[model samples]
Target: MKKLLLAAALMLAAATARAEDNVVKVNAPPESAVAGETAPAKASTIDCADTLGVSRVAEVDTAGGGEYGEQYPPKPLLEKGEVVLTFDDGPHPEFTRQILDALAAQCTKATFFHVGRMLKEFPDVARQVQAEGHTVGTHTHTHRNLGGASMGQAEQQIESAINIAEATLPNGVAPFFRFPYLSDPQRVRDYLAKRNIAVFGIDVDSFDWRWRKPEKVMHNVLSGLDKTGRGIILFHDIHGSTAKAIPALLAELKARGYKVVHLVPKSRIETVAVAEPTAAPAPRRRARRHRRSKR
Candidate 1:
């Protein structure tokens, strides 16, 4: 009876361990005597079954009949110790500089989605980003509303920017492309898939669009970041306000106890545009909530 009980106990232990291994672990924010923070979450915070969509650590079935082949998706998050901060519409000389200074102080790496025109104008800042250990991606030749563009138009916008970025960047390599607006269609996804580029999308947006007021954007970001620590957090690095906001942003990020990680894809540079369609071009017009189908 004792031997039989021992065998059953071992079986239970094995099952529990397997269940634990399957859970997706999210990095918890650091705790401080500081006010307004969520304590670090445990592996138990993840509903392992549902988060396969966002798993960066596990071996995901890659494109083709192989494993995580030559081209794989960006690391979803650091293994319970990563935070990916992504900036878009940048290389704005003033703002990008401030943003970089912020990262430099923390030794944190981030992904910057560069606009082609902006990159042309501020090649120095773009170079600085790579030099400082941040990843660079294309945000399109013109920040066109992809939802309003055709297939050829979309391809041109993306490919042209990639060419320009390749020419300007080190080694003539431009790896990832993000749609100007986070617009996704099956056709668009299929087109990119053919090239083995993963669509980089934002999991959270700070809505810093509202003001030049650093405090407002900073407040919005810090509060939201407390909950969503591991995935991409979007902020614009174009405007004067965002530029001014970076120092505080980085400071708050540190105070909150996030490991500022420079997010670079292990395989290829993956660019994602976090966007919703603007249905109408007219002022005060709203895009009908009509489901826009994708290829």
Candidate 2:
């Protein structure tokens, strides 16, 4: 009887240990505290069934800058449960930082598309995003809807955005671009192709912009995922709702067996030497003269 009782206790302990593997626990350091680390901790080291961290990184070669997304062809070959996290229209002052905190809490890495004006306004915040080792890309100089703009204006918008982002980021910009408002004209699409910049489209739109509440954002994402299964998921770092939505969304993703895929460019995007138009030529000359007099 003693020998049988000891064997039963051993089995119970083993079962308990096995069950604990599925319990998701989050213990993340503050974003400011993780600067010294090379990259976010790889969740692959932990059992896939256990952690809500990055599952794998997909290195993409932006050769000829092919367009991709569920809406476009040659999607990133994700398995049924894998999803890529991408954010655009950042880096906002307050909300971007909050989103970063939530993402770090899960050890997840995401791709950020920074606007030129936003980059200039919050350069320090942009640098912090880079310091955290997330992939960086440009959206446009002003987040203008390119579909309505002249080809020259579109080119200028795209080029200026990349130039500003490359100059701001320590690592330079990736050869990745996403159309603002998902409005991609064939002419602009072909232009990006010529520049060797990959175009990204959305598989699932979180619509966090419309659904300002955390629960609404979460529902939209999970429901969309239910239909699409896997692809690139879009969020905006400028919204407080998105930051609030992320933690619970990540937890739900883990519970539902969804894995996060980090996307990296095989090479950096080559920027063209195009000068941005001066907003006020007279003011610029006056400022230069004032500085010269000071000198």
Identify the leading candidate in terms of TM-score. 2
Clashing pairs in 1: 109-262, 182-275, 187-295, 200-271, 200-272, 279-287
Could you estimate the TM-score for every candidate?
A: 0.65, 0.78
Residue range 6-68, candidate 1, lDDT tens digits: 443333233223333333322222331221111122322222221111112222211221111
List where candidate 2 sits over 4 angstroms from the true fold.
1-50, 277-295
- Show model 1 residue runs off by greater than 4 Å: 1-81, 172-174, 267-295
lDDT per residue for candidate 2 within 1-295, as digits (tens), equals 6674344333323322333233221122123121111233322322323446666655666667777786677543577888988899999999988887676556566889888889988998898787666788888787777666789878888898889888998878887898877777899999998998888887888887667899988998999999989878989999898998999899899889898776667667788867663441121112221122100
TM-score for candidate 2, please give it: 0.78
Cα deviation of 191, candidate 1, in Å? 0.9
Model 2, position 259: C-alpha lDDT score: 81
lDDT of 2 at 95: 92
Backbone collision count in every prediction? Answer: 6, 0
